[model samples]
Target: MEDPARLAALETLRAVRQRDAYANLVLPQMLRDRRITGRDAALATKLTYGSARAQGLLDAVIEACSDRPLSEVDGSALDALRLGTYQLLRTRIPSHAAVASTVDLVRAELGSGIAGFVNAVLRRVAEQDEAAWVDELAPDPDTDPVGNLAFTHAHPRWIAQAFAEALGSRGEPLKLALEADDARPAVHLVARPGEVSADELAAIVGGDVAPYSPYGVHLETGAGDPGDLEPVRERLANVQDEGSQLCALALTRASLEGTDDRWLDLCAGPGGKAALLAALVGLEGGELIAVEKAPHRAELVRKLTSGLPVTVEVTDGRETGFVEGAFDRVLVDAPCTGLGALRRRPEARWRRQPADVGQLTTLQRELLTEALRLVRPGGVVAYVVCSPHLSETVGVVADVARRTGAEQLDTRTLFPEVPDLGDGPHVQLWPHLHGTDAMFCAVLRRPV
Candidate 1:
C-alpha cells in the first residue's frame, strides 16, 4: 500500500509544477486543510521543500539512470523518483525502507509496472556513497559548462558568484551564506508591544530573548504548535523572523521620534510589518494606513490587525489617491528581488535571475516616488527593500531623490541602537555580516 506521506509529497510536487506555488506557502495550507499534524506534516514539509530546493541536482541524478530525458518522463513518475533519490542520497533513512516506500507510492499512482522503473533508478543512485554522488553531481571547476554546473553545494554558478562578490574579500562568509541556505532556519517570533513584552512572550514560548531588540524572540525549538500555545493565540505574538522585525523596528525608531503622529506602510501585504507597526501605532496613539494592492493580501492585512487600530486599504501604493503631505511618516517597503530572504524561501535561488533585479528597480523607483509624494514635507520616508542589489537599493533612491527633491538622512544616527549599524547615509544589513536578511533601509526627507 502507498504510504500517506508519499501521497502528500506527490501532491506537493503536482501543485508546485502546475500552480507555480511555493512549497512553503502551499504545503502548510494543504496540511492544515487535511488536518495532518505533528510528524506527518513535518515530514511532508521537508520532502516538498527539500526536493524543490534540490530539483536541479535531483534531475541530474535521475537523468544519469534513465535512457530518456527527464522532460520526457511522466511528471508523477519523475517526482516519485526524486523522493526516493532524496531519501537514498541526502537523508539518513535506511535505503531499503526508502526504496520500498517510494516504489509502493509509484505503483499506487502510476501502476505496478512503473514501480520497477522507480526501484531500478533508486537502487543505482543508492549504490554510491554520499561523497561519490556529490562528486558525480559536482562539475569540473576548470571547464566552462561543467564548471558552471557545480552541484557539490547545489546552487547555480551565477548565484554562487554573486554571493562571493557581495561578501568581497571574506570567502568564508560567502560559503557560510550558501550553507545557511541549505540549513533549516530557526522559528522567530515578534511580541506585540503592549499586548506582551519580549521577555514575557519568550518565557511563554520557551525561547531565548533576542539579543538585538526588545520586541524580538528567537525560539530555539518548539515551532511545531503555535496554536497550542495560548500566548500566541492571544494576538500578543506572531511567527516572524527577528531580522524582519529588526528592519521594521529600525524604521519606526528612525522616524517615530519628535512626534510623527501618523504612519503609512506602502506596499504592505501579508502584513508582517503592518502587524508590528499597528501595535506601535496603538502605543503612540497615532493613526496608521496599510495600503496593499491585491484584495486577498489586503484582507490578510486586515485579518492580522483585526482588533488593532490600524486601517487596511486595498489600493496601489503608487496611486492610492491620498493627499500629498498627508502622513507624517511612511514606510515604502518596496517589492524587489527578494534576495535577502532567500534562506527562508528555499526554491527562490532557482526562480530568481539577474534580469529580475533590473525589472524590480523600475518598480522600486515608482514606489519610492509615490511614498515620498504622500509624506508631509518634513516627515520621514523610509525606503526599504528586502534585497541588497545596488540597483534596487542605491540606484532607486538616488534616481527618486534627484527628481523628488528628497534629501538623505544620517542612517547611522537614526538606527544607532542596532549594534554594528554604524552611522551612514543609508543602512544596508548583510546576510553574512548581521546573520540577518540583507535588508536595506534608507531614510529620506522631503524639504519643507
Candidate 2:
C-alpha cells in the first residue's frame, strides 16, 4: 500500500498551494477521514507542516536542481518533490526511502515520466544537507545580515524585517525571533472559566498548566486532535493560545468602576476570545455582545458560546449601530496580516506580504475607532491583534488614540507577572520569549 502519511501530506500541500487552504485546518480533517492515528498521523503532520514551513528554502534547492523553473513544474510533481526534499534534508527518514516512496507515489498518480523527474530532482536535493544548501543560497551576512538569517531560518525576508522592526533592533533579538518561527508550537487550551479549573483540566488531559494564563494548559505537541480531548468535547475547555487568553483577560483585569455589565467583542468570530470573555462576564452575571460580520463565523461564535451569555451579531463592527458609549468594556481583536502567529500557521509567513499590511492596518484602525465609540466613558477597550507588525499594533492604537483622545493605559501592567514585556502602554509577546503566539495588545479607555 502507498504510504498514507506521505500521501496525506502531499494532498494537504496541494490543497494549500491551489486553494489557499490552511494546512493546520486541512491536515487534521484529512487524518481523521483517513483514520491515520498515532505515528502515522504524527508523520503526516511533520511532513505537511515541515514542508510548508520550509517552502522558500526547499524551493531554492529544487530550482537549483531543476532544469525548469518551479512555475513550469507540474503542481503535483512539485508537491512530491517538496515532501521528498523535506524528509531528505530535515527529517531522519533515509534518502533512499524518501526518494523511492515519493517517486513511487508520483509514478502511481502521474506515470513513470513525472516520477522520473521527481526522482531526479530529489536525488540532487539529497546530495547536500539543509545546512550546506542554506550556506550556498543564503546572502552574505556582512552586507545583508537580516536576509542571511532569514534564509537560514526559512522565513521570508520581509517577515524577518517586520520582526526586527517590532523589536526595535536588528541584532540578536531578531535572530531569536526568527528562530522561534521555526519551532512548532504546542497546542494551548483555555479552561472554561466557570466550568473547569486549569488544574483539573491539566490533570484530565495530562498536559501542563501554562505559566502565565491562570486558565491555560499546554498539551504535548503532536498529542493527537485536541478537539477530541474530553474537556474540549464536553465544552469544559477549548483550544486557545495563552497569549490570546492573556489579552482577553487583560480586558477583565483592567480596573473598572461603576457599572460593569455590558461588554462587546467588536470583531469576535471563531470565538476563542469571545468564549473566554463570555465565561468571565457570565461569572459576574454580565452579558457579552460578539459582533462578527461573516455569517458563518458568527454562527461559530454562537455555537462556541452556546451556554455562555453571549449574543452573536452579524454586522460590520465599524457600524454596529448599537447605542454609542453603551458598553462597559470592549475588545477590538482586529484582523491584520497575522504575522505574529506564523509559528502556529507554518505557511503564513510565505503567504503574507508587506503590501497586505496597509489594507489590514486601515481596517484595524477603523475597528479600534469603533470600539472606542462603543465603549462608555471610563470603560477600557483592549485592542488586540495576532500580529506584532507596528502598523497593526501600536500604529493603529496610537493613531486612534490621537484622533479620539482615548487614554492609552500601561498595557504591560495588565498582564501581571508576564516577564520581558518591554516599555509600557502596549505589550508585544514573542514566541521565543513567552512561548506563545506573538500577540500584540494595547489597552485604551474612552475619556470621561
Candidate number achieving the greatest TM-score relative to the actual structure = 2
What's model 2's overall lDDT? 0.92
- List model 1 lDDT by residue over 24-43, tens digit each: 77777777788777777777
Q: Which stretches of candidate 1 lie over 4 Å from their true place?
A: 142-150, 225-228, 255-259, 412-424, 430-432
Steric overlap count per candidate: 1, 0
Worst 10 residues of 2 by lDDT: 389-398
Residue pairs in candidate 1 whose N, alpha carbon or C atoms collide under 3 angstroms? 412-423
Error of 1 at 370 (Å): 1.4
**lDDT top scorer:** 2
TM-score of each: 0.90, 0.99
